[model samples]
Target: MPTPNPAALEFLLTRRSRPWRTLCLPAPDRDALHPLLTAAARTPDHGKLEPWRFIVLERPALDAMAQMVADRGGVTGVEPEKLSKSQAEYATSPLAVVVVAAPKPSEKIPQMEQHYSAGAVCLALLNAALAAGWGANWLSGWPSRDPEITAWLGLSETESIAGIIHIGTESAIPPDRPRPDLGKLTTWFTP
Candidate 1:
């Protein structure tokens, strides 16, 4: 018989992402963050191709990236409000993990699967941080989709930002948002 972990189930049921704006200082240090990263790395990879990597961005790096976002936004003629939001996301975060989707060459595995795996890694990392008693939120803005930002972050041509997971202490707990109705979303098939 498989061992049932009620606590784990309870956690999953109640897990809620803290708002990025609500995240404050006292973020996890390198030593504290290492295990969370390790846990994230354990996410499923269909072809055993680790199609993702994490870039731990500290305060200074975040500030630099925020500037880059603003500069890139200017060059791209992005709307001022959008640009400001993007800049704030980077500048205000105490710590962030950029989950890059670096798909590997594979004849058998589809590129879509690799992309899905990368997304999984992002969620895994977010969950890991949350489980470790840190507030975390996965964010991807215009910068995440822009080639200039990718180049600034030192990603190869094929690698893209799957997510930018902001991690820190929660200054305020956000009220729970409405969840999907599983009954409505689910479909049971019988033959």
Candidate 2:
């Protein structure tokens, strides 16, 4: 029989992501964040391709990214409200890690599998931060898909942002929202 870990299971059931706007200062330093990154690196990868990399964005980098969003929005004719929302994501974040999906050329592993691995990495990073007692939220907006923003962040043609995980101290724990009805979503298949 496999040993059961109730605590870990309970945590998985109750884990909730804090709101990005509510995250405060005193974000994890490099020394503190290293372990989270290490944990994130342990995500499942088919063919061991490791098709993801993290870009840590501190306050200064966030500031620059905010400006880039604004500039890109203006040039691309994006709506002002939408632009402001995207800009605020970077401008107000205390700390953020961009998970870049960098697919490798491989005949054995499909590109879609590599993309899935990158997405798993993003979730792993978010979970690691939350488990380490940090408030964390995953976000991806229009800016993440923008070509100009991708270039600015140094992502190559074969790479894109899987997620932007913002981390910091939690000011308040928001109420849990409604969860999916498992019975409605699940289907039993008997052959």
lDDT of 1 by residue, 125-154 (tens): 899999999999999988999998898889
Error of 2 at 160 (Å): 0.7
**Model 2: colliding residue pairs:** none
Per-residue CA lDDT of model 2 for 1-191, tens digit only, reads 99999988888999999999899998999999999999999999989889999999999999999999999999999999999988998899999999999999999999999999999998999999999999999999889999989998999988999999999999999999999999999999899
Per-model TM-score on C-alpha atoms: 0.97, 0.98
Each candidate's lDDT (Cα)? Answer: 0.93, 0.95
TM-score of 2: 0.98
